[model samples]
Target: MDPAVRMVFKNMTTDLAEQYPALVEPAKLILKKCNGLPLAIVTIGGFLADQPTKTAAEWRKLNEHISVELDMNPKFEVIKTVLMKSYDGLPYYLKSCFLYMSIFPEDRNVSRRRLAYRWIAEGYARDKATADRYFMELVERSMILPTQQSVCSIQGFDSCQLHDLIRDISIAESMEENLVFRLEEGCSSNTHGAVRHLAISSNWEGDERELESTVELSRIRSLTVFGKWKPFYISDKMRFLRVLDLEGTEGLRNHHLEHIGELLHLRFLSLRGCHEIFYLPDSVGNLRQLETLDIKGTGIAMLPRTTIKLSKLCYLHAGSGSGDNEKTYFSKCEDICEMQRDLCVGCCSLDLSDLDGFGRCEAFHLVCCLMYPNIIRGIEDSGVKVPRGTRKLKALRTLRYVHLAWGIAIIKEIKGLTGLQKLGVVGINKKNGPGFCSAISSLSHLESLSVRSGDGLNGCLDGMYTAPENLQSLKLSGSLEKLPEWIKGLQNLVKLRLELSKLSGNLETMQVLGKLQNLSILGLWDDGFKIDVLRFQTGLFRRLMVLDLFYSRMEIKLVEFEEESMPNLELLTLSLGDTEIAFSGLELLQSIKEVRLSVHSYLFGTPKSSKNGGNEKMGKTLYEMMKREEERNKPMQDKVRQELQAQLDRNKNRPVLKVQ
Candidate 1:
């Protein structure tokens, strides 16, 4: 009846404990052998959960096995024995996948997508979906621990990490089987035999001379660098390398990849955070077997035209935001500066009245271009261009953040890539709106889509009356008269972000969004709606967990949450002007946990009042009114605090309230 023992039984056998009360004592006796170690208890519990029968005799047999293992081994060895027994129970397919986790460094959060792609590239699974299933199975077995979940609920866990104890066992097993070779600072370079997978970590003190002399590079199928990059590591000898993951590796230059094209068998190449590299060598076109090429967060703008030759490419991720050089350019934007310093808002609202023929979204881009032409040039030209004859890459599953400025011809080329599941394009305009829409509708497997409009354009997205039903995440930044009717049909949608859409206070649009059954995250940024009051009606947003409402120019006088609305909302973030706004119905959020509020006077370098004498006088009066409103609303603010505190005191999940 110890708490830990009871917890193990409760977690592993909820109904079994109640059904077979006679087995409780024997289960406790087995759990007692864990000696208060949570990991051992969980591992043993997971093993027992998989048993075909739940009986007193079976429980006694397990306890006897644990007693025998403990008696035969030392205290430290007992824990390892228990873990090894669990590992021995795993199916053959999962064993290799589990051992592969040893390639990652300690405390690293391994991305789910990255791991799945690597598993597929290693020939462990037929495809990404199959690899993902194997990942989940390991998680269920308590072998891998989940660290984060995806914004889209359907995508499941986003990242995972192995416990130190589990990782130690994996490292031992991998080296014993000659499946992986790990190189660290001051470690011996003697890899017993053929090195199939090489993981170089820490500050590697040895140079290419020591590596080349001790290790055989010819047979290295995968090379992952967690520390410094040695140029000679990618020589022509590594012909059989299938995965070259130099993600975040230091000292990597453009010239270092001169021989990358020779790795004809390379299926996965990720230079995700290598900031020094500007362009890939033309020789990269030789990677005919490449499937995943990730260069997001790099200085690379346009890829080599030879990229079009990668007919087998499945995932091409490039252009996340302003690269290293463009970071200085973004500093000039006052809105971005303010957001970064205090409010931390994702999107910035701009005043486009002075800029002719430009939507708010487009005006922001134009302003950046005008301020520092040279600096902004790289940021503006960040997206990868869809080359001509790109239709040959029919195997593509993901093509994200591509520049649509390539014109309708390039936009039309995307229509031929029918296998694309996730697509993101920037610089949409009225001229190619129909073509873009036509191309999108043809992608039957598209699950995620993001479209940003071009400068001086409106209604670019109005032509889309239909969309892929399987869409789970959609982000749109433009000017729309109303919410697309097609969005209401996307029953599978899980995360939706709308920026600078200027919905014109359409209450029907709110109703349409509230009806989405699977929506968990909703962001309405930079005047997504021009309404005076934002309200959540009763019985709506039932599954919503995170809600972000950031407004710059639009003054929302009140945000009312009707009873029974957003019952599952846990985190709420709001940005408001220096105006008195009532936040009602805090007690109704049964699952509320964190509330972040920011109050500011002006934003986006646009003052609410002009410096002229007459305007200054008006501003003084407005300031006085706001002061009086704040004084009058003191009691309401206290009431808000009291309700939040009450929720924290009564509910097991404590709520956090932050105001700036």
Candidate 2:
């Protein structure tokens, strides 16, 4: 074995002994079988560390079984052991969700929002929050590796993927349990016993025989079809079905949903990405047990007027995608070009006045107007409006993108939503600003709030005396002449995005924001702020991990960090906007892991003038200067890199952070 592999093995063995001293011998045996494969060893070790009982006898048994399986399947010995052990260790609640991953296509990112809702609808968990916990557990165990989990951590969109080995094992185990029946192109379902859940993949085109003759359709509990198929009248026979996910089905006209009321047990229905579903039947109101109704990215402009009957519904997604942008792992579903005009719910005159039955709903998400204000004007001009009576949803927790026409009545109703944890809306004007400010203060449970003000957010903040104590994430986009007085009170704020703020003066508000101990990410976009000389005070922003001020090149010219300021900051982004950096006491702070500078202007001919002064220009960003004279950005960039590198080398533990 290579020296590197040997060192890793030795280090891993020592860690295992520390974690489970009693099972060290069995761990050694497992590691021997792994042959220094780090993934298996680390995964298995983590798994054992979480075990309820760490008896040596039980581990010896597991070790012996793994060794025997390795000999039998020499091709994929280590991975099989790790996967099988992981599956066996899962609690009963997570077992089903683990198996359900096999339903998605190979190498596809499983949507966190989509899957969590499915689990809630399928009665796998009590509610959406419970289902989310199950997902977090899987992620913690490494069974599901989330794509860009950190990118959207603040936004709450956690999508993930299953490794191929884990995927295959899930598929095989699902078949053995008779929990899922995957219908392939020429394959027929086994009618030997009752198969409860069935899925038709995109590549499969099974004939009618595969559904009617092979399996008893009435016994099916879940039917998920991701293919080109006509399931127009199939709901009549699947009376016992609880979940009908037709997200990718085509040509689904009103006839498809006409008889949907017959399935009394149906709880979850998905029409996302369905191009042919122009209209829905009134029978949709009959699913009193339904928990989730996903019509996102579909051609359905209007829902059945009797939608109030679904009193049990908790999650309703009516938007193609939200405006709260974050780079996720999954690709957006292919658009149905034929129904493009009428498909988006935002562009239509959707009068959402009669959804009073959504009183029990926890999450009510609609594309109120994540679109630009100009696009919204062109779309919602013809009387499309989000009506009043949302206060009726006392149980509501997440209400997003509501185009509140801005009045006393609307603001009063909003104040009644005391249980709200997350909310997003296109705000009202000055006439209703007082009421809106009062309402914002009343909702004490708000953890995440996103407001896109049509008439400037300053009006809404005018009367605000206090911020939500628990508010952690906030996104505000609009004109801002002054900082909100309530902002300093939000000590729990973790992520904040302030857009289009023309801030200036003594930088008092910036200092207040810097003192927030829990702040993790801060983004200042176009027209954010203008300060001549920005200085960081020591002992401020101690818990910040990502500080993103890299915007509007030339807007900020000079910045200096005092020692002990931002001691834990891992990522710092600065827009070289018309200004250069002056590092003060930078050598004292050695915890910085990365520094990103977006330089838009710097003169090469005058290096001394560039450092001693500020010169705004347009040219190639990264270019080399004469070898003896100086590098293109020798005054700032090259020197800064060299100093940081020296600090990192002296620390020994900190690796050289990538500078871009």
Candidate 3:
């Protein structure tokens, strides 16, 4: 049992026993059946306690409802009954927020602020006044328990979690009530299917027969299908649909999407992982009101010819993936890459071909295919001329994964795109000059800047480009052999990540990063060798909250440091490299509420006392102590410890150390 759960149930049980004496015994039995499940205890227990009638008939009806409504999932029937009873007791306004959670995926953790935001988005609550009040009301009633311990200072709610079982139950009830839909099983419904809003899984292959049944989908307004589905034809009957989500269904062949142009009213069409869907029929230009089109995984080998006509299209994820199935279209930028509207080219090599027809684009991601020469040829063949002044890209704000191979050419051409706010790219070429770096540093609104590492090329980042002043988050990975001095200039950086390194993190770089006042999450992985100086400099990270250091080669003992340095730190991870590292003070990391220690170090000395030894009882007691430490979150820790101590006392007269 989780310690948090034990505390919650113990208090709730005691309160119910005093207030609702009649159902207290039965409630205890039900809570025991829950096995300390938090969601069940809070939601169901709260509902049951508020019931106006505890008569035999009402209780029987509740149990019957559980047996029937929760028949498919018997494992959590008790929990479902608890929630059903509680839901019946809820006021009309609170019920709305609780039911709205079904909109999120099952077992997903939701923050109170985000949930409130979504409620506002859905117009469920008129304003923050009603939404916030309802959220607090739920917390006060103990219907939605807070997942975190309130530290008096933390304002508002940070995060909340529903028991996985309860989440599933909520989703089931919501799906039945038509609030949401999750197509886990095979799609058996025809166009006349009763489902209002649909979220289908394309991860599992559907029968071709499913398409035949989709002919009457005219009434369906919104549809979300997983991107992994093999290219399948969309029925012409889906004319009434407004939103079509094909996220992660990369297998949509050109012919499979022929009917998309017919849905003229379609406002949002997401092809997030449609990497293989290389061609969009010119018919797509007919969607005059199409607001968003996401083709995140569409790795265009070259530009397409017909995209130039999409006047109202605001978003597109037309980028390639790193796989054999990767697909790219060949066309000019004016004709393909840069339509008459905004295009979101995710992970696709940017080919500034056919720039003549270019229009103002809101955003573009150049993180794909950093290999320059091949992409350049594709751009040239498209006949899109790159003028000295590319005015159309001026409004762009975010750029990511731009390959450094074409860094010089692109920077020179797209210098007019001065509105960038977030940028992620690699700098490996000697030709990457101060002007290119300056061009990047000019974007004042830039909040997140990530640099690609130069692994095989050491000393490549000696004095890299100076970062923009507004940069708040910086992530470095994949062969960043050394830290450059220019990083210190980005004083506003709040979150930093250094992953997959080769003997990096020297003292100079650490000292510069340690001074950043707003730094929050810091993740470092030094697989090659240990640099212990950074570990002791915990005080330098004054405002750091979360720290993760993995697979280090350091020789220091992890248990020596006290937690007083990280006053605001909440989570800490220490991966030990040597057996001499003691974990005695691990429980004393004052500020740290949660700690994860990996025991990779080898255990030294002969067996303390194997089961084959004379002091068998002593060996068992020690084994129990080790097990308790391994399962640290056990709710009955005190009782378990006392039991082990008694066993140890009984074995005190035996040999303390006996050879196997």
Which candidate tops lDDT? 1
Model 1 residue 43 distance off true place after TM-score fit, in angstroms:
13
Q: Which stretches of candidate 1 lie over 4 Å from their true place?
A: 1-73, 151-153, 321-382, 454-457, 479-481, 502-506, 517-520, 527-531, 542-555, 567-582, 590-643, 646-660
- Cα lDDT tens digits for candidate 2, 340-368: 35435443555455644221110112332
lDDT of 3 at 481: 52
Question: What TM-score does candidate 2 reach?
Answer: 0.67
Between candidates 1 and 2, name the one with more favorable TM-score.
1
Between prediction 1 and prediction 3, the one with superior lDDT is 1
- Candidate 3: 10-residue stretch with minimal lDDT: 321-330
lDDT tens readout by residue for model 1, 1-660: 247666755665556567777877887676555544576676666666667977888878766666354345354465787779879999999999999999998778999989998888888998878999999999888888888864334567989988666777788889888888887776776655686898888667777877777678887899999877776677678889999999998878776776789899999999988876667878899999998999987766567889889988988988763211112122123433353343222225445588654344444444544554654343434566566788888889999777665556767778999999989877666777788888999998999888765352265766778888888888877667778667888889889987776652457877899999988888876642346767888988889998877665565666777878998998887665434455666666788888776654442223267779899887777777766655665664565556546644654556677874
TM-score of each: 0.72, 0.67, 0.56
Q: What is the C-alpha lDDT of each candidate?
A: 0.74, 0.63, 0.52
The pairs that clash in candidate 1 are none
Clashes of 1: 0
- Per-residue lDDT of model 3, residues 287-390, tens digit only: 76654555545543322344434444433333331111111232233344343232343323355554332221201222222334345333222112222333
| Maximum-TM-score candidate | 1
Task: Assess the local accuracy of residue 140 in candidate 3 as a C-alpha lDDT between 0 and 100.
Answer: 67
